[model samples]
Target chain A: MSTIPEDLSYTKEHEWVAGLDDGRTVTVGVTAYAAEQLGDVVYVQVPEVGAAVTAGDAVGEVESTKSVSDIFAPVTGEVVEVNAAVVDDPSLVNSDPYGEGWLFRVQIGEEPEDLLTSAEYTSLTTAES
Target chain B: MSRSTPLREVHEALGATLTDFAGWLMPLRYGSESVEHNAVRTAAGLFDLSHMGEIFVTGPQAGEALDYALVGWLSALDTGRARYTMIVDGNGHVLDDLIVYRLAPEEFLVVANAGNYPMVARELTERAGSYDARVEDRSESFALVAVQGPKSAEILAKLTEADLDGLKYYAGLPATVAGFEALIARTGYTGEDGFELFVRNEDAVPLWNALSEAGAGLGLLPAGLSARDTLRLEAGMPLYGNELTEEQTPFDAGLGRVVRLDKPGDFVGRAALAERAAQPDQEDGPGADALRLVGLVARGRRVPRHGYPVTRDGVVVGEVTSGAPSQSLGKPIAMAYVSRSAVEAGGLTVDIRGSHEPVDVVDLPFYRRSK
Candidate 1:
């Protein structure tokens, strides 16, 4: 089982959104459950910083040994930062999906919609598994 | 629900990610697939290959019957030796690539891929009806476990007294491994010195456990199909569904070496293969002449996965059959069939999604084990 951080909000596509202290910026990464399901991630492609993305847009991709999955944007926002560390070592996504493996930081444009709480996300993951 | 192998519980106990492969629920990976792939190259990796088919051809004229049933001249094959051969249809279209072990003067063990074994068994039965041979599907009665790597010999030597040092590649023998009856063969898909142990279905778990305990200090990890695939890709070996298929002949896949045209005696696909061989080069023709299997080394991080288009300039010239990030080479390598002209012209690129990633033409078997 993977850890579902109580402080973070999750999307149906298995991305976690961490609201920053500034309230305008939020860090996003694949949930640990998603990372675990993907096995060993060999490569990660993230959207360019400063690019505007709409909610549900496939902003990036995570390639594992067996398959690949699109990393979708949970909310409409401008990409503020991308994690070069995860790009350099894709295994970090499997190791620390919520912390050091955070894929990108987005400056919120419109308020996030329909994000699931930790309890709800846990239920979703449990049901899927 | 997909069928489970005898070692299914063992995989679940180890937290393996299971997937349906050829209708069998097999382990795709355990933890990190990269780690397992690297282990096979550097140390050792255990594989549960019970899902593979084990068909027995035995009787007074088994070898003669096999000679007619398969492309190889099996009657001449020495007992205890295994030959890498293929079974093709009447049109020379490959059915499945196989490894046939001549166990005795009148008995052979035919190991077929999981998905195609049933068809192979049926084909063998039909083809051998005129000869004094019997084909039996013993897949359910047997289990296969392979220990592959540089350290495989030493690890296996500790358990059995069966002269691991003298067991030549592609040879098998009946032996007692950890007190269990097993037919240990020095063969594997991974390009490493290894042994594949064939045991009874009930002995699968015990054999795996004994090997695991013995291989622990030697860095043997339980590798799954995901790593197995990458390792074979690095070795430039073809998978049944990807590279070799019923739609293509051996010559089309550049695996004509396994087809024994010189072998005396009429075999299945012999006539069609001979006709194809005698024909003039079809350089301008669309069939067989257009595609030639070749290796591609990506210049970038993006991998050239199966079915990705291979192009030169702007025209699509070929398609990738198998590809992966090679742990040994530290770059993505692939086996693709490119047009002979595009191959000679030299600027080949694989369309990675929408981005055209430049790939340098290279030789197959990206990694070879040191003898």
Candidate 2:
């Protein structure tokens, strides 16, 4: 029953990307399907601001009660901002995976390729479940 | 397709998350596992344990056969009582942990883990060839439901007219529950006061419904295997595939107290266990430095899950057996087998994925109910 917002792009790894209106940066977080599969999120590790990352690189980690998963970079860029609120209370990932649970904002260095549209992501999650 | 318990439909009706456990379709959680766990801690929680195996051993030689087959002195175990014991191979490796209930002077009921019970029944049948006992697998005929927590007795008292006060821990008696016959045992694995009802398969739904109604006023929730795992982990109980297995003996798992060497008659694994006990404490040798089960508490929220390596000074010394987020302690806790040398050195860390997280060694049983 997870809703995939039409405005956001997604990764096969279950991460969702919201491109900011400025077009220079994007906010990233895990999809609601990922959060539901994880049951409860207890800890989140976000890359420090100013760290350089390439697309598809593992930049952070999400630790749930029973399991742990890595957060991959959606675009080749430098981390511009990290969400301290999500780090303080990780349950936001389960409660609001697409909103306040955003992990970090990255300044896009190269336009990402191979990102799935919302419809495709929806189909992928449906096939998986 | 996996096997379904008699209560499977009822669980589906409640919208429980079903998962495959030991080839059986069992409920993993009703809703939120943490909510069920907390309910068991603060009040009481009901569990559908029909997946467990029940084997009946009856005849005049039932007690004698059990004593020779297992590690405990079942012949001396008083009637209407139950004892926790283990079945081991000739090499002293544990096959399964069992709870044997002496229901009558010549009858005994052996309850075993669902995954290991078929093997247990086969082993019992093979071992009892010379005795006058008859082993029958009654697993299909029975459905088990347990109400566990501090308020378990209070909830159960409303359904049955049986004397709840007289039933001691581990004692079971035939009682009428919700107008159906049940063998009510005052036993549980959640480190709380509870009752396990063994009823016919046809009575499972009615019994569960009756208990649900009686427990509504009190804080009884339907719990699943996920919550049960955490509850037992906090109680420092050893799980079969985790803390125990054929690769390790009861002594290696710090459960030597359950082995009865002075119980007169010869039992399986007695010779090997005696030889093991007589060996000198040799450092780094299989005699004494095999492994010691210890508790590990995470300094942070990253849990040390099963098969995670436990390290000391960057050297892998042990592996985590069972771990979870302890609702009562508000932290992640685990049981691991640390080598003697690493344990003595003090500083320990759990390799969570690739990152080594600092951990503190603590005593087992992170949570204990106040009697």
Candidate 3:
């Protein structure tokens, strides 16, 4: 079973939002369930820092050996930082999806309300699997 | 619902990620596909190829029927030997690529792609109307398993009494494997030394278990279609739907040599293929003025996928048929059909999404194993 940390919020697109409790900046990465489905990640294209993104916008892409998927923005925000480590070695997304595989951080523009709690995210992943 | 192979339960037990392929449920991968691909290159990889279609042609005139049905001169093929050939429509467009194995004096087994076998069987039956031959589709009752890599021979030696040293490439012989009656064919698509075992569907699970047990010490792992695709791509083999289609002739894919124009009798697409063969020679080969298949290695990390346009100077000159991150080459490679003039002009790039990624044109087959 894929791990769903109780402290983070998630979107239906399978991205997890961390540090949302602080109400200012939040780190985002694809969930463990999404990583498992994607097999091996070979390339990662993250949004540039300082770019404004609306919720549900496809801001980046995650490419694997078999297929490619869009990285949707979980909330409306301006990109604060992008992970350069994952860009250099994409396998980190498969090996450590939650900790070091974070894609980017965003400075929130408005409070997000549609993100799912950990329990809801668990149910969604369970249904998919 | 998709059809399940005989080893469906085995794949499920191994925690493989299953995907629908050509109306059959097949394992895409058990773990990391790259690891599986590497295993096949360095050691050995087992593959459940039961999804491929097996059509048997038998009787005194089987050779004549196949010669008329396919491009190659099957009648000239000796028993126990196999030849790669293709079936084309009346217009000379490739219907499907096939491997014809002569099992006996009057019997031949034609292995075809899963998606095109039904049509191939129907076409063969129709074409053999005047000949004393019988075509049978035995795909539902037969199971195919392959062991591929440098260590394949060592692993298979433990199971069968067949003369491993005597068996040549593209040869098949009946043998008892793990106490099961099987036709061991020294053939594979992974560009490695290997053997493909054809057995009854009921014997699949036990045979797989026995091979797995025997090969456990030789670093053998169960590979999936995902790995198989990359392996064949690195070997520069043309896939059915990707590199070949009903709209393209074998000449278009640089495989015109498979068409035997000098055969005594007239075969299907004979006149059209002869016309193509009569065309004036070009720098590369026949049909150089038309779109020619070429290999592309990407300079950037972003992979170029199927259906992506091959561009030069912002103009679409060709299209990518197959592309993947090659484990053997340590780079992203692809097969695309570029126009002859564009190939001569140089400066090729694949339009990956919106960005034009520069690519180098190289010879087909990005990887070859050392003997």
Query: Which candidate gets the maximum lDDT versus the true structure?
Result: 3
Residue-wise C-alpha lDDT for candidate 3, range A30-63, written one tens digit per residue: 9889999999999999999999999999999999
Off by over 4 Å in 1: A20-22, B280-289
So what's the TM-score on candidate 2? Answer: 0.96
Q: Which candidate is the best by TM-score?
A: 3
Local accuracy of candidate 2 as per-residue lDDT tens digits, B1-371: 89999999999999887889998999888877888999999999999999999999999999999999998889999999999999999998899999999999999999999998999999999998899999999998999999999889999999899999999999999999989999999999999999999999999999999999999989999999989999999999999999999987778888887788889888999999887766565212363346889998999888999999999778999999999988889999999999877877788999999879989989888889998
RMSD of 2: 1.9
For each predicted model, how many residue pairs clash, with residues at least 3 apart or on different chains? 0, 0, 0
User: What is the per-residue lDDT of model 1 for residues B282-371, given as tens digits with 9 covering 90 to 100?
Assistant: 212245337888889999888899999998887899999888888889988899888888888888889988889999988777988888
TM-score of each: 0.97, 0.96, 0.98
lDDT of 2 at B34: 85
Pairs of residues clashing in candidate 2: none
lDDT of 3 at B90: 89
DockQ scores of the candidates: 0.79, 0.64, 0.94
Which candidate, 1 or 3, has the higher TM-score? 3
Q: Which stretch of 10 consecutive residues in model 1 chain B shows the poorest summed lDDT? A: B280-289
